[model samples]
Target: MFRHTKATDLLNSGVPIHVGMRYMGHKSANMFMHYAQTLSKTHEAEFLRYRKITTDGREYQQDPHEMYEAIALSKRTDRVLPHGYCTLPPRQTCDKGNACLTCTKFVTDESFEPVLRQQMEATDGLIAERQEAHEARFGEPMSQENIWLKGRFQEKNALSKILHTISAVRTSDGTFTPLRGAGSPQGRQEEN
Candidate 1:
């Protein structure tokens, strides 16, 4: 809910789409490309729920900004969250810009897979439900965004596996063991 509220508020407040993308934890604004689609779909859904359109409906043309207004008007009266903090490091200062692949935040290690998987599943479900409407409005399937998100998630997952293996092979005392050498310090030398 915090994410939705922040995203909705950002859209309504005229915050640049890129700023909202970062606030919503998107790796790239492209993954969050359907901001207008999201607003439009939610607005149309709510509008349809509250008012019935006639069978003799004529051509309907809405102002491009109508969806943005609807989002603001539908704002919940309650706070999005009771408490929260921004723990993520400032990325604006970094020069990576999603190309260098040097930022640790984007990398997955074993510790973050469960969280990543859960997030991926939730995102997939949300995108799936809005699929048809998004395509109709945007002339592109919402899954295109999902595909990019999933690719990033998978890249993180693969990096995590590699890191996990590297860590596992290290000794308790912090020394890395040689993979092909015989076992023990001297290897069958005089039964030492």
Candidate 2:
């Protein structure tokens, strides 16, 4: 019991795990885990009667920004994008406009797969049309150096990559790809 308490307190206090293990005189990670592990939360979960926490089961009662607004908070809310939402703070507008797929804070899940698919197909078609038009006007095929054309290709590729990750893994109706930053401190700090 004392071993468990000491381990718990040290670990919860943000002590390094290896350091804690050395302080506790444990060598193997298995033993360290055995001493530090606690089942209190898991044990308590058996008493939960209802899984649904809300009426519509959409997660929150209302948009979080609305709650902030009700309290007269000065915080800015997340901007909604076509596929997902931007995590960029109001102070820092994205310079890579229309490149949300490659942006650090551009979070999305399997739910947006349909929109992504449609967008990808549309981009592909548009690229082809634009290429033909460019060739006709310039008497040469659109070079890779064309900024607008290059950007379109990058967007198309990013969409394809995101779609591949989405389809490769799924949880219920949504699969969060590891690339996008959803819960990063940058966005959360601004809200506070």
lDDT of each: 0.43, 0.58
Worst 10 residues of 1 by lDDT: 79-88
Clash count per candidate: 0, 0
Give me the overall lDDT of model 2.
Answer: 0.58
Q: Which ten-residue region of model 2 has the weakest summed lDDT?
A: 47-56
lDDT of 1 by residue, 37-151 (tens): 3565544433322111111111113332442243233463121111111112333343544321223323222233345355546555765667767788989876644765565
TM-score of each: 0.24, 0.48
Candidate with top lDDT is 2
lDDT of 1 at 156: 48
Off by over 4 Å in 2: 1-78, 170-192
Q: What's the true lDDT of residue 151 in model 2?
A: 79
